[model samples]
Target: MNRETLVEIKNLSVDFSTAKGALHVLRDVSLSIPRNRVVGLVGESGSGKSTLALALLGLLPDNTGEVSGRIELDGENLLDVPPEELRRLRGGRIAMIFQDPMTSLNPVFSIGTQLVDAQRNRHPQLGRRELLKRADEMLKRVGISNPEARLAAYPHQLSGGMRQRVMIAMALLCEPDILIADEPTTALDVTIEAQIVRLLDDLRADFSGSIVLVSHSLGLISELCDEVAVMYAGKVVESAPTKILFGNPRHPYTLALLACEIDPEDEPGEALVTIKGGLPDLIDVPKGCIFAARCPSRFGKCVEEPPLCEVEAGHKSACWLA
Candidate 1:
């Protein structure tokens, strides 16, 4: 662990018990969440992005068969933390804004009740009135208009964008050191998504802690991330600073992702660039490079698994070509 990093995931792997057997969702994944930085986790669906995020908070589902490797919080391995202590750290030291507010928020509770309850793990001594006050302030901070009024509103009563904002407020209420926002804007419209992105970007000033943004949207990642880690088939295929990765992607998978991005400059009737193959089976993972079948640059060298080695200072890619 470094002085600047708040959380570190090293050699992490996860197995989920499905009907078909254990699905290896994550494989030797390592990442660093530096203090006061937004790190984006990007890749297509089934890339284990969400699994990695859930692992950070130790919130993996009960069906999770096995989880190996270290998740260090300030050099203390979170995997070793007792359940009681982990519960304390969950909302206080680390919070997460899940993908869908509709599903995450309790339908029976008012927005105020949920937000106030979110802080209970961290602020048990605070009375309901005090917690409600804190929740109101956070709602206002996240741009909720008429915060007091919205506090009484139920999740079903609020608009989609407003519900999402409430989720952000709930996450912020605990003043967590690390916030994992997994596809925070996935359910919103393009316009609302842009607003949410801008809001998160603006929050950097108010929040001095680290942020882990898990999403497949390269555009959103480029906009908010200080660094980006590109995952493919449960492995981090490439990791680099945002500007460097976006401007000069090294891995073939990363290059393919950027090429497939929807560009506004394309003329009418222009065909889109798309990757040729689908993701590999997690149960029967390839022995060699997981992306070889989809990689345009793969040759005989790809027959062997490539280590995630540094191609340049602060840039790492898991490809023989890199």
Candidate 2:
């Protein structure tokens, strides 16, 4: 079976109205998600990871000033699709598992009800009983025991891990072609985080869809993603296969990000590695390489912005040095 591009993003850019100026959230970003592959988006808090995700789902905030780009799903540009078609595609062809399950799940409804509602978009012909059965099986698949009773419980009734599991079950219930998990393990304990990671790993193997893991955890990205895209400020500085990116990153930003990863087996009392400078101001982004200000290897040629270009087969980087 050919693993062709399932979703293709080209020159995607987004800006928001801010008191200072137009805050460029995403800047000429382009990426490809191959079928059944796991792609990771790694960046800092303000790197616009979530914004990009929301943009893909056509869920950008009302404050968004401008959005220009082509987000193609199986060759169809979703950005140009009608509102009704886009709405149907949001949870039907594409679905998302937000960072905080507690906030993503409704406190007022039982898990069963929410799960059934989630399926209605994709399986409108299925009856309530059938949806409930499917939801029950999905909950069990996500490692939630006693699915029947758990379905009847509200989001507040479950533990943090359980709530996250419920969120996963709900997203899966949609039978989407693409699943976007935005910091799915955020705020969970070490044990629960590990569980969620393992669960995702298991699902990626069996699920017939591609996944986008939006996370700050390099460790997680290195372990789970087939490909990795590194973002800085509001642009993708580097992206490549997981091994290629981690083994031999081309951009300074990617190198700096790898250097900041915590090594569990390191010598004791070592100060935690940290990136030097903070993110650049998106309102007035630097003209040259976004990472040049803090890049230790900066040179005179970096004064002008570098376009993301292929430096090697199947690898691309946006740095003059690359």
Whole-model Cα lDDT of every candidate shown, in order: 0.89, 0.88
Q: lDDT by residue for model 2 over 1-322, one digit each (tens)?
A: 4659999999999999998889998999999999999999998778989998998888889899988989999999888998899889977989999878988788999999999999999988999999999999999999999999999999888999999998888888888899999999877877898999999999888898899999888888988999999888889889999999988999987877777665655421121136776788888988888888989999999998899999897799998888
Give the runs in model 2 whose Cα sits over 4 Å from its true position: 265-273
In candidate 1, the residue pairs with backbone N, CA or C atoms under 3 Å apart (3 or more residues apart, or in different chains) clash, namely none
Model 2 residue 256 distance off true place after TM-score fit, in angstroms:
0.9
TM-score of each: 0.94, 0.95
Model 2: lDDT of residue 102? 81
Q: Clash number for every model?
A: 0, 0
The digit string of per-residue lDDT tens for model 1 on 1-322 reads 3438888899999999999988999999998889988999999888999999988988889999888999999999998998888888987999998878898999999998999999998899999999999999888888888999999989999999999999988888888999999999988877887788888988888897899999877887898999999999899999999999998898998888888776745421121236787899899888899999888788998989999999998899999888
Which 10 successive residues of model 2 have the least lDDT summed? 264-273
